[model samples]
Target chain A: MKQLKIIKIGGGIIDDAASLAQFLHLFAQVDGPKILVHGGGKGASEMLRALGIAPQLVNGRRITDAATLDTVTMFYAGKTNKAIVAGLQQNRVNALGLSGADGNVIRAVKRPVREIDYGFVGDLTPAGVDAALLGALLGLGLTPVICAITHDGQGQLLNTNADTIAATVAVALSEKFVVELHYCFEKNGVLLDVNDDNSVIEKINLTSYAELKEAGIIADGMIPKLDNSFDALSQGVSKVIIGHALKINDSLKTVLCLN
Target chain B: MKQLKIIKIGGGIIDDAASLAQFLHLFAQVDGPKILVHGGGKGASEMLRALGIAPQLVNGRRITDAATLDTVTMFYAGKTNKAIVAGLQQNRVNALGLSGADGNVIRAVKRPVREIDYGFVGDLTPAGVDAALLGALLGLGLTPVICAITHDGQGQLLNTNADTIAATVAVALSEKFVVELHYCFEKNGVLLDVNDDNSVIEKINLTSYAELKEAGIIADGMIPKLDNSFDALSQGVSKVIIGHALKINDSLKTVLCLN
Candidate 1:
């Protein structure tokens, strides 16, 4: 199988122009077929505030009402996505930006209203991915830069978690390629100590992941991220790497495996 | 050559939700491979107002300063483009959206500063378009939804005139497709009597188009549109149609031909 890299960047890097430019410069240098999935950064919130739409949150997750969804869609799928695509073009990378709606690449279901209504949020499953379409795009020598907005295939656009989108796409494409999923953020890597950035775990397998959790080193927010990472490894994704967005080419990162 | 329909929609249809949905349905029902190009409507201006950035205009044309370009890029390529794509997907059209930066499909030059500087605005010729990539996309059975945001291929994104985009793309793809460029707007067609929608001329050949311009019937804003239409026909586009976006399937439209 050919090697393919699926890199996911969070808001921290996207929120800063200098960091994003540095990251894009590094990303353009990455060899082989690659796809970029980006998160909705602070720009959306700022726009929401500017538009007089109050930002709603429940348990650290955004409650994407119609107005909020519209704003985020504009910021993420529109501004940020195009900026990155144009930047890549400057570097000679043929980057095409996408929302899940574009080419129906990712179809997602609106999260059900249980105790809390997530409004227009989408919950995606592996089957919802259109691997063939993505494969065809990659075959076209076009690097897809996907935004976190997906559609229900019935006219409704849903706000999805970018991390899950990256993982799902990586898993879907694993059939044709050795997929390397990179979750790029502000941190160096998955840290062994919360206070020390240099306390990188370096590597964590299923066994060690459990040990880290029991030791409370990988508790709280990093827990869901790691769980998601391990899940991808279990489902045919070659490996999941978490690291700083700017230092993607560097060796200082945490690698997750199912082993 | 295979037949391809390149339809361009201005802000009138895009600004209204129900109208946009209706137009998307009609677009999906059109036969053969197609492409849709859209203009930035009032949404960008509304956003600019929200962001407290006063819009600047010279001779009724926007001065696309850095701030204006940023807002317009978000509105056109991001929000409007995605909405159209998602809507088309609901109609089962399999629409793939693009900005000029995506796949370097439309390489533009920053408009030269002359009497006025239209900051970050792009100027394109037919030769700047990437027809092969578009043909490949069409061959994949995907309909392209293009926004009026193009790149200089060196990093900067420029706000382009949507009508020009429609015409240039039609001219570029004329090599592989018998192209029909449709300029869909709020009106039924170009009115022989400016006040009467029923006064559509139905057909205008090259000679009559000039006479109409001289007679002051097809004057003002319609002049540039018709000029663009005639230019496309001369460049091998099979024809150019001007009509209401919702009434695309109907024959009550002005057809411009070289004959």
Candidate 2:
């Protein structure tokens, strides 16, 4: 059986058709069973603003308030999901779109609040999944496109993070596959210096991650990305790559661990 | 506490924007804790064909073969999921998109093949859901926009059905809130006369369902749908509404039962 690889595309990289097309072109070259997890934070926020709504974020996560939730359901599931599917089809890649709520794929409980409130956010619990279904789709030579929304036991929608979703999926498939998590962005790679483009770090192991954190090299948004990568690695993923969505060849060099 | 409602959007309705926008507009008026679960079957299949890949279905369920699995991950999670989010945002709904792989929301085991080989499909099992997380989100007045995809215990992506997803979610939340399920489509309602537009049934109860089924008034696609609805009702869903997606007001009128 071919090994499986899981890749995550950041909101920054997925905001445009050109970037998405470029990414898909490269992705078509990769071998084995692969899955892509993506974020729509930037687009979703922009759409909200255009609709005269103020977007709210709780700890960097979007708050799916009543109105916002409706917008997201329509936009993410209806528009963005189809655009991606159509894009892949235009590129000659078979793609099927879906959400966690479709098959109780991700059963969630509402997020608990002690001090701050995060509306419609859910924390996931362990539920048995149907791997045979996935294998069957792969066997039929179709690509599965998944969205980052789930449901609680009672069929309520929940907002979930893309990085976490990718990491968890990688862990779940690690035993039978080689999970390769890619964090595609505009940057070349993980930079060692904020100002120097030449300060890209070739690689860093788990042991060295703390040192970088202590040195204040990894902070803010990068923190969650790295944390999610490490989480997947610890859970038996083969590799985690962070690089540019465009220029896949250049990123592939970094991804291949040839740096 | 606001009552919880679970609204399920069908692929037929979500296939186009005009219908989806209208659906979201109505969803915005649901003044309570609500969750949105959506499907992308038709879109996924159409996209797959355009990409030169043939879709495989086993007994009306998608066969998630290796290539199909890859296609769906990209189509469902990356595209359809975001599209829905974007649409909701257009209406000022702060929707966040997600898959089950995030937060381990829904865990499952690799479903063993029975009669036919349906690769990569998953069946749901009982696992604790994080209701507190959802409750917090609802408490904060956020709506959840969910996609139908989940992960197995080993972390592999599993293809699942939208109706089943909605049913399980409804059951999960029944204990804490009033779970109102709306399965929307282009049809006015379940029809007794397949060719007669006026044959729309106002309501269906558990007692009447058998007669309808026996008389062959409920067949084909409606069978599975009604089965799912009844399952939810049996499991304690407060109500199930089946109607046309475009006739929003009329659709809301077919309330099957109220708890």
The best candidate by TM-score is: 1
The TM-score obtained by model 1 is 0.98
Q: Residue A36 in candidate 2 has what lDDT?
A: 69
lDDT (0-100) at residue A14 of candidate 2? 72
Against the reference, the lDDT scores of all candidates come to 0.92, 0.65
Query: Candidate 2, which segments miss by more than 4 Å at Cα?
Result: A1-259, B126-129, B251-253
- In model 2, what lDDT does residue B100 have? 53
Give the per-residue Cα lDDT of candidate 2 at B97.
54
Indicate the DockQ of the complex predicted as candidate 2: 0.04
Candidate that would win on DockQ = 1
Per-chain TM-score of candidate 1, chain B: 0.98
lDDT of 2 by residue, A210-248 (tens): 888999997777787777677667767778887777755
Candidate 1 falls in which docking quality class?
Answer: high
Distance (Å) between predicted and true CA of B206, model 1?
1.4
| Number of clashes found in candidate 2 | 146
What's the C-alpha lDDT at position A51 in model 1?
A: 87
Model 2 per-residue lDDT tens digits across residues B158-226: 677667777777777777787788877777778778787667888788778888889888888778778
> Candidate 2's error at A149, in angstroms?
15
